[model samples]
Target: EKMPLTPNGKLDRKALPAPEGALQTGTEYAAPCTVTEAKLVQLWQEVLGLERVGIHDNFFEIGGHSLRAMTLVSRVNKEMSVSLPLRNVFFYPTVEEMAQAISELERLEYAVIPQAEARDYYPVSS
Candidate 1:
């Protein structure tokens, strides 16, 4: 079993065949419930070249690996504006869990500084 290679001695990814139909994994198929989850499912399907991906399906179990995980993270960062760690993919291997992690990373957690505290700042340029 060998991957198709281009004339340049590189892997011919386009020549790779896609998985047939929906991928079967250990967990039962569950459609994404939230927008984030739906986005993750779409990304996974695109990255893995599958027809359907469930929110509960494990990324690795469904034909994902480190390389595909990187591609997924790159797509998520580009499309969702959320930075995801590669290791986190292993930690949150399911679409639902990865979506939750992405949501947490995208969440804005900030504390408003007191108005009076602003007065203590000295203008360095002025």
Candidate 2:
């Protein structure tokens, strides 16, 4: 359906109705399950100034922007000690996806780290 326009021939944004299936009404809210998810949710809440955040909630949909996204990435890196690409948050944009990416990165880092080994050194008499 076409959107309604004002007298000046501009689209009336305020008159626009919420998108179908986008609004969650009377639905039971689910909290973050894992530690990563929980930390992400907390960071999101602090950055977005929202009271509650769900794992599936879109970051941009909840008032997140590019600057906020950077802040989120920095916080995640500091808190989780994982280097997450900025684009990853844009691509994922959800706690669940970001957490999964972090987990994967952690796993990859673990695999790449070499195990500790003892090295024998001999001294030569001069």
Candidate 3:
């Protein structure tokens, strides 16, 4: 029950045992592919308090809940600068799916601009 230490009294990182992948969470580990996916992974890991989070990992399956989902949404909206609805979390639990959704949303980011209402009739070129 002791940690491997070097002569300098520091923890020996090399001596430590490697984690056995996803902590046996029954899901194959797949690292994030794109920038969007990578960012989602980082945020999921932070919210779930896990050392590793794969792109294909299910948010709820990997210790996620409604409350945590809200927090994750808030972070995504603020950091990613996109309006990611909370319902999307459940709709797209995996990072891969979420990333795709994000890209689609980003594509339509400026599509919701409101325009000034025009009068009932066209204005004359007076």
Best by lDDT: 3
For model 3, residues 3-120, the per-residue Cα lDDT tens digits are: 9999999999999997675556688999888999999999999999999999988999989999999999988987888889999999999999999999988522323358869878
Which has the higher TM-score value, candidate number 1 or candidate number 2? 1
Off by over 4 Å in 3: 1-22, 107-126
Question: Candidate 1: which stretches are off by over 4 Å?
Answer: 1-22, 107-126
Candidate 1 lDDT tens digits, 6-117 = 9999999999998676555768888899999988888888999988898888889988999998998778877887768889999999988898889888633333456654
**Residue 61 error, candidate 1, Å:** 0.3
Q: Would you list the clashing residue pairs of candidate 3?
A: none
Candidates' C-alpha lDDT: 0.84, 0.83, 0.89
So what's the TM-score on candidate 2? Answer: 0.63
lDDT of 3 at 88: 99
Candidate 3, run of 10 with poorest lDDT: 105-114
How many clashes does each candidate structure show, in the order listed?
0, 0, 0
The per-prediction CA RMSD against the true structure, in angstroms, equals 9.5, 13.2, 13.7
Put the candidates in lDDT order, highest first.
3, 1, 2
CA displacement after TM-score superposition, residue 24 of candidate 3 (Å): 2.8
